[model samples]
Target: MLSKDALDTLFTNARTHNAWLDKPVTDAQLQEIYDLMKWGSTSANCSPARIVFVRSDAEKQKLLGCVSQGNFEKTKTAPVTAIIGMDMEFFEKLPQLFPHADARSWFAGNQANIDATAFRNSSLQGAYFMLAARAVGLDCGPMSGFDADKLNAVFFAGTTVKVNFICNLGYGDAQQLFPRSPRLSFDEACKIV
Candidate 1:
């Protein structure tokens, strides 16, 4: 088991930051985060999360136009805004990812299953991404207040992928955090068979 502080870094004390410091997140740190997150479990190993790290001012502006007013400034000020997307054709890579069996055939003609798996696994990956960022000493602000159609059009043109959400990454300004909300207890949230 990880130490208490290690767990705190990944979950207990991690906050969804809306305000950022002027510090820039390094590209190497982004790569390191991916290295950690990609190892997270996925059904059929369908690692479908495709991320576009919008770092430059020009790229950030493009993304800014796609978000709600509440998210615009937060995203703009953050060092990186990860456009977390899922590849519709992720099953095509099953041969490489889950080579023990012909996994690609399982979703080849089933659009419904493909959509479900892609969305589910990608969302899982996004969660892993947030935790990984925190483990690497960066704070995360995952946002869903964005126009998916506009974001897809602007960032994922000519691709079968679609946006899952946007996450701003940086060293955050602690003063801007809202009080931490309460979570349900184990009895309230879980039921053992």
Candidate 2:
């Protein structure tokens, strides 16, 4: 178990920010987040998540068309929107990522295996990404309310990658936050056995 301060910093004190302060997230900060998130474990070490940082107005406009109305304003005003995606052909990179064995062959030509691996690992990476962002003093707004197909078509066309989620990163406006929501208790949401 972690210390109370560490746990609080990562979870209790971390808020899902919906409004930003017009502050830009430096490229170095983004790289730092990636460096931290990449250390997170994945099945067979198959890290499938790919991120495209949308910071320019042009890029933001491209994403605006894919996100729903609820997410449009917040995402548009954010300093950076990370397009978190999963690569269906991620196994091909196993030769380098999992070089100890023939891991590539393990997922070769299997659509179900590929999809499962991509979705699962990418989702795991997404969680890691959110934590890492919080750890590095950035507020995050993670949202799934978007048109995945349209996002993929606009950003990942001609590729085997698909959008899983999007996260807006920047300095948060605490004044705009709603009351904190409730959470499930350990016994109610977990299994001791």
Q: Name the best candidate (by lDDT).
A: 1
User: Candidate 2 — what's its lDDT?
Assistant: 0.94
For each candidate in turn, the TM-score is 0.98, 0.96
User: 4-68, model 1: which lDDT tens digit per residue?
Assistant: 99998888988889999999899999999999999999999999999999998898888999999
- Stretch of 10 with least lDDT, candidate 1: 56-65
The CA lDDT at 46 in model 2 is 95
Could you tell me which residue pairs clash in candidate 2?
Answer: none
Q: What is the model-wide C-alpha lDDT for candidate 1?
A: 0.95
List candidate 2 segments past 4 Å from native.
Answer: 1-3
Model 1 spans > 4 angstroms off: none
Per-residue accuracy of model 2 over 1-193 as CA lDDT, tens digit each: 9898878868998899999997789999999999999999999899999999999999899999999999999998999999999999999899999999999998998889999989999999999999999889999999999999999999999998999899999999999998999999998899976
Tell me the lDDT of model 1 at 7: 91
